[model samples]
Target: MTLEQLRALVSVVDHGGFRAASEALHKSQSAISIAIKNLEEELRVEIFEREGYRPLLTDHGKVLVQKARTVLSQARDLSDLAQHYAQGVEAELRIVVSEVFDIQEVLRALRIIRDQYPSTRLTLFVENFSAPLEILEDKEADIAMVAGGEMFDKIEMTRYEKLCPVSLIPVVSGCSREQKDASELTKEDLHGATQVVVTDRSRNRDERKYGILETSVPWRVNDFLTKKQIILSGLGWGRVPLHMIGDELASGDLVPLSSSDFGPVEIETYISRTTNHPFGPVAEAFWNLIIQRDYEKTNKITVKLQ
Candidate 1:
């Protein structure tokens, strides 16, 4: 019933005996036993079987102990949240990223954030197309890294920076009928071919489709990875990020299928915050980390050019 009683119950289960629980909690063994007894009486369940040298948890005790651990974790999180606010640190940082952007860079930035601010909860939503922007506009995300296109022009961002350019290559499985020895295939050749495309995760279904052939049969998927898998399985042909299909391209498992209308599509990706909402200390630090990484990358490219 009480947190102390729950703590005592969990401690006994974790440390394996009444005396050990007392030692761990810095309480007397009798006090620990009394706490457990009170908890068991209140719940009207036998918590422990005191038959062996070490007390064994009853079936009811095991279930209650798991629940107790969850309660204790949430209690600690509440305490941490209070402390974070007192220190001007954000309790949570949510980032909506497009799947086209390199995940390694995002993972590296997250690792640094995790090390620097352990208490700040980080939530990352990897979406395709205009979904990241939709989440940002809805105020569900703090920052978004999305691919730039006509849909991107509609948003007015409070903060914006170009991240990188991603190239989406039109490809098909080597085993597919569309695969030919010629360097290029015409639009007529792929008129009826099934094209796997990632569906926008946004509420706005009217968003214009990019790099899609109007005549091709459409097969919609939720993510680029799934789209790539479908194409690899010879189920369909579609455009995927060049970085994602590098190995498959090299192995000839996936063959590039370029036409007048279908070829490599270069998309400029950007990281931006739409709202003017003031960022907490942790969010500011994370934003700076991303900017710094971009700066370093630019400098490296500039140095090579020099």
Candidate 2:
């Protein structure tokens, strides 16, 4: 009936006995027992079978405990939301990052943010293709690190900062049957081979099959790392980010596959956020950090050019 009673019930169920629950809740054993007795009487149900060595929830008690947990969770969320508004700091910040973007830079930024805003919770979702954009549009993410292309133009962004262009090179395993140089291989040469592709994670969007040949059999994967591993095993050929496969290409573990039909694709990456919603303090700090980093990189490039 009350939050205290609910907490006492849940604690008793979780901690195994009245004594343990009292100890965990910092309440006397008598008080815990009294709370449970009052709750059972009010509900007109036996919450625990007294015959057992350890306290066990009765059938009805199990159902009530589940409901109590939901109520408790919602109550905590409400409290946190109030605290967030009062303090001007987000209770949680969600970021959806495209897998193609180098995660090392993002991780470093997050490490700094974690230390700066210890009260704000951070949730990172690594998705592929159009999923990051979709998540941002749906208000499921506070920010998105997406590869800018035609799909990115569809969304209206309040703030965005461009990063470096990512090069996607079509590659095959060095042990593959086709050993000719990349330029010598034609579209026809790769038509019969299996092409590994990362599936779009968006739910409703009509997925575009980039660089896929009509004649080639396509193998779909959810992430790029798996796709890269499949291509490295000689099971299939696929285009992966140059950053991810630099060592492999240098060591000749993976061979580049280019032809008149498909050679390499380049796309710009952006850190974007929508204007529909205002950012809390933590989110604002993170956005500023990303922009500062971009500015620093640009100044370095300009100095070198000068």
Candidate 3:
């Protein structure tokens, strides 16, 4: 019914009994007991069953505890927000991005952020697929850019906006003609061909592929850069983000592959921030600028990694 009553109930459940709850909450056993009793009275139902040696939450109590935890979490978020505002310009902005975003766009935007907020620190985390979303959920990042497919169907976040579609191209090493030059290649044509694919690094998500043929040999790499290297080595064929392969494709170092199954597929990318945990001033400004940029769709730029 009240925060105090809810906290008391949670403490009792966590610590196993009234005596332990009293010790944890720094309250008398009678006060703890009264708090639980009052909550039951308010709800007009028993919250705990005392038939066993240790009192167990009634089905209702178990359900309410989850709701109580949510309330507590939100309450803490509110307090943190208040503290953030009380402080002046945020000292740092932490950003997590998936591999699909054009690196040039990101670097260009970083330059602008640096000029605008000279005193603020900028931290960038480059991850693949669902890892960006996971970092955001863990409160390790203030903002994230990820593939639209990486987002959960049921997600509650402060904000989300789709950016320009990122292009994906199927390519093979220039030398391996195993199935290259096929204008309309099929799963059967590419069967048993080694396919070097960028794999999801997060253990929480299921493995996914963009252009895998049913019969292609799968060679997994954790990042696009590594995948590009593997493909460039004439070891396998795979679909890679267009931004990452522009130079290779332009130089004929990688041969683009087309199939009856599909052509160049574009993935929708989104910028997301957590709900309730509002971004501080610097992060909000940078986020606004990132989403504002009119980035080139394909062949954006060739970012040479040092």
**lDDT, candidate 1, at 197:** 90
Superposition TM-score, candidate 2 onto the true structure = 0.66
Question: Once superposed on the true structure, which residue ranges of model 2 sit more than 4 Å away at CA?
Answer: 1-84, 152-159, 204-206, 259-261, 295-306
lDDT, residue 9, candidate 2: 96
Candidate 2 per-residue lDDT, tens place, 1-306, comes to 898999999999989999999999999999999999999999999989989799889999999999998788567656656766787878789999989888887887888899988888888999887788888876678898887555666766546778766778999998877745655787887777899998876764536566788878999898889999999898988899988999999988899876677778887778888765667888888888877886787699789999
On a 0 to 100 scale, what is the lDDT of residue 213 in model 1? 79
Judging by lDDT, tell me the better candidate of 2 and 3. 2
Per-residue CA lDDT of model 1 for 1-306, tens digit only, reads 888998999889889899999999999999999999999899999989999999998898889899998798567556655755687877789999889987888889899999999998988999887788888875678888878655666766556778657889989898876677424887777788798998876765436667787898999989999999999898988889998999999998999875565678888888888544556777777788888897898799789999
Tens-digit lDDT string for candidate 3 (138-251): 677888888755555545664777787888888878876653564566667778988887777685574556767768778887888888888888888788888888898888
Top-TM-score structure, candidate number? 3
TM-scores for all candidates: the values are 0.65, 0.66, 0.71
Q: Stretches of candidate 3 above 4 Å error?
A: 1-79, 179-185, 203-208, 295-306
**Lowest lDDT 10-residue stretch of candidate 1:** 76-85
lDDT of 3 at 109: 83
RMSD of each: 12.1, 9.2, 7.4
